[model samples]
Target chain A: MKEYKLMKGNEAIAEAAIRAGADGYFGYPITPQSEVLEYLMAQKPHERTGMVVLQAESEIAAINMVYGAACTGKKVMTSSSSPGISLKQEGISYMAGSELPCVILNVIRGGPGLGTIQPSQGDYFQAVKGGGHGDYKLFVLAPSSVQEMADFAKLGFELAFKYRNPVLILADGIIGQMMEKVQFFDQQPRITDEEIIKKYPWTTTGKTPNRERNIITSLYLEAIVEEQHNRKLQEKFKRMEEDLMFEKIECDDADYILIAYGSVARICQKSMELARANGIKAGLLRPITLYPFPSKQISGLAGKVKGILTVEMNAGQMVEDVKLAVMGKTPVAFHGRMGGMIPSPEEIVSALKNKLIGG
Target chain B: MTEEIIIAGFGGQGVLSMGKILAYSGIMQEQEVSWMPSYGPEMRGGTANVTVILSDERISSPILSKFDTAIILNQQSMDKFESAVKAGGLLLYDPHGITKHPTRKDIQIYKIDASEEAAKMGNTKIFNMIVLGAYLKVKPIVKLENVIKGLQKSLPSRHHHLIPENETGIKVGLEMAEKIN
Candidate 1:
């Protein structure tokens, strides 16, 4: 039987990680997301599932620990807020370059620097556009509700291993702190090393004297070899783009559309209803995966709607993608509230009217 | 039916918890509920607030600018949230810490001396329950029985012993709440 419980998003993610049979969770504490680590510690999941939950000295250290565990072909995860995620970029880049499978959660707060601890989608460009150096991409999932927060934790691990790449849960402070009903899925036991070896024969789990030694490193200093490696990564990125995920609300025969993700998407949902009630034909296109952005979906809506309004908690990041997707087929406008402030539904409605509807 | 509410007060005054209880009550009645709180530095001894929504259908946004009801517990919250109430909406406040009462004429304002009443009952911790009871009296969005069931769901088992006193506080609030406007 499925059991439902009212839980905070951060806590839900923590429980989901344990239930997903994650081998290790290494994270540092940060506001608006500390509950992930706090809940793990309180639950003592290590005793129950034999999962290692470690509080690293810093976000950098935590990501490195994840890299170490992931090298063994074990499912591992790390979580932090915006600033901490920035600190983990170097490690994340390394993990991506090595093609290590891991999951990362960034319960984002407002920032250009050490900004407010309030929720913001300011990290959109950093997350989807790749904050780390070199040519690499993370399979980023944007969860709008607490239920998705839990579900995505499991889904992220699945996708991570499937692609042999790092997966990111790009959530905002709103979803991290908000409380809602969540139904946990059935528990999955941690995959054994033998099973992992069969799936990923190129893992560094000690030589079995059967095949060539597996070397996991991003350093292909040779020019021709480096080009081949870069090309491979690009191919993976292209394949990732094919995995576009999105949700459309009232898009059929709508004149105006809003493109949004994460918490902003939920707000746009309300704004759509308000606009429809006011006799304005409005719809919403919510991108669930930020990196593999629902560009094709947005393109389909471009031909149907008069204009696309991209609403976010950041200044203007994802709007660029929306514009690229629409490709001048439809007018694209951007509205946002940066630095820890969330745009209210009424504000979004007004923006839709003024910018998209030409009111 | 949908009820969008904002509950605001001091950090330790159970403002957020009150909102959680109401959300739980809505869930008990098989309604959709979302509880979003104002987090960060403002949570440390300063004014804290939560936006709660209960609807028969799906809740679109947890973030709302205007509210059907504003449950104010202190002067700062009263000042900040009074204008946020929709016209003909309900604004309920406790008279304990509020110096400047709500002056909005379009909305219905009510005052419940919950702090004084809870103090009189010898346990000021029930202050929020009293205020919640008064809000329910004004607009019974959820049944009182469901609210008690919600209290059970929101409170940990260790604190279950206090439900009887909380019920009493709600009863007192139901009787004492007076509409000021």
Candidate 2:
């Protein structure tokens, strides 16, 4: 029988990737999330699980390596923090344009520049809004806990291959550095031949697959053909928007709702309690899927609540969506802390009392 | 309801180990739990911290802002988190390390000499467990049976021999904290 052990979040993500039937890991190390690379070095997946772990020359090289492996119809993954993820974006855009299925993990750190190695949710916009180029979405899964770190990828890789697209595990330094219980198990290969053939019958492997040669190219001779592809990507995005998940806490009775996601949810929860204690009727709404964005849930709460106040680690990535969902029916406000400084519960309460409640 | 707690202290004081026990017992009580330690640079420093969030609900964020309670092994920790405690929050301090009681009268303060208590038990390392035991005595969030199973889950397979000392430490703190209350 498999056993349970306390593992740091980065290590858990690495181990989970292995068990999810990933054929290879290509990554470059950066702070806070360095343990992800370090754990792969220790697990020695190459010798044990028939998995290949490559230390690429840089983030660009690593993501392109993922593109190469995914072309072979293998489950390949690459991981980096914010700055490194920024470097990988060009390759990610290329992967998306070519419809090459792969997975990327961004254990986010503070940013704009080579920000501090501490945790930050600054990359929300980057992950959801196509950081690299040309209208694409990385079916992003924002996991707030270590158990989710262990559990999210098996589903992520499956979805990547299903849609023939890239999937991202968006986590923060706090989730990366913290340790929690993980249950280990062996599972079937994540990418099956039948599944690949169902979509990409023209996978680039040893010749013998299809009669004619197949070259995956993102370039289009005419702008009209390129516009067609862009419209298709927009349709996929709309489909994703319809299927999103979020955690709703006490929103039915709340006149003022606290909107936050990722690590910021923890601070928001405590703030909600304090707000309620201070005679402000507040609750919390946390979206698990950042890109799909739980807009429908927020839309439902629009008429029920007086307002929605979005809290985030960055200036305001999610607040824009809160505004879109509320549609100016109820006021949508924002409170934020950046550069690795976490906002205290008192600060959040102050924002609520001063903004949502007082108004 | 089960709560997830994160207790952070320096390496010598057993923050990781205490967090393990909290998580182990938390699972045994049929609660969803995670015991996360401060890894990387923080672990090597003069201070350490862990965040444990035990909840009846499916936990969304492993990070914690206000814990239902906090156990501070040192005075610096108290200063670091004194403002984090909510009104009616519980503070457990080792009298030897932190002497300044919180100014707020709304919270419950349990002052114990965990180091001296561990000395009485003939083991200095169990000072962490003494504070842990007092936590169980005061909070009673997880059942005693779950705490035992949690020990089995946390300790290495070969270190099963040390389980007895760990239990004694918890029992001592429980007995002592019960007397104080």
All candidates: TM-score of chain A:
0.98, 0.94
Off by over 4 Å in 1: none
Best by DockQ: 1
What are the per-residue Cα lDDT tens digits for candidate 2 across B1-181? Answer: 6464547556788987798788878777666776655554556667888877676766645655777677777777787766666677777777675577556576777776888878876799888888888988888888877888888877878988888888888888897763222
Q: Which 10-residue span in candidate 2 chain A carries the lowest summed lDDT?
A: A184-193
Which residue pairs show collisions in model 1? none
lDDT string, candidate 1, B1-181, tens digits: 9999999999888999999889999888888889999887878759899999999998889999899999988888887889999999999898886788788889888989898888888999999989998999999899989989999998989999999998988888888789898
Candidate topping TM-score: 1
Candidate 2 chain A vs. true chain A: TM-score? 0.94
* lDDT, model 2, position B52: 79
* DockQ score of each predicted structure, in the order shown: 0.81, 0.34
Q: Give the residue spans of candidate 2 off by over 4 A.
A: A1-8, A40-48, A179-186, A190-199, A221-225, A273-283, B2-6, B36-44, B55-65, B82-89, B95-108, B116-123, B137-140, B143-145, B171-181
lDDT of 1: 0.91
Location of the lowest summed lDDT over 10 successive residues in candidate 1 chain A: A1-10
TM-score of each: 0.98, 0.86
Model 1's DockQ score: 0.81
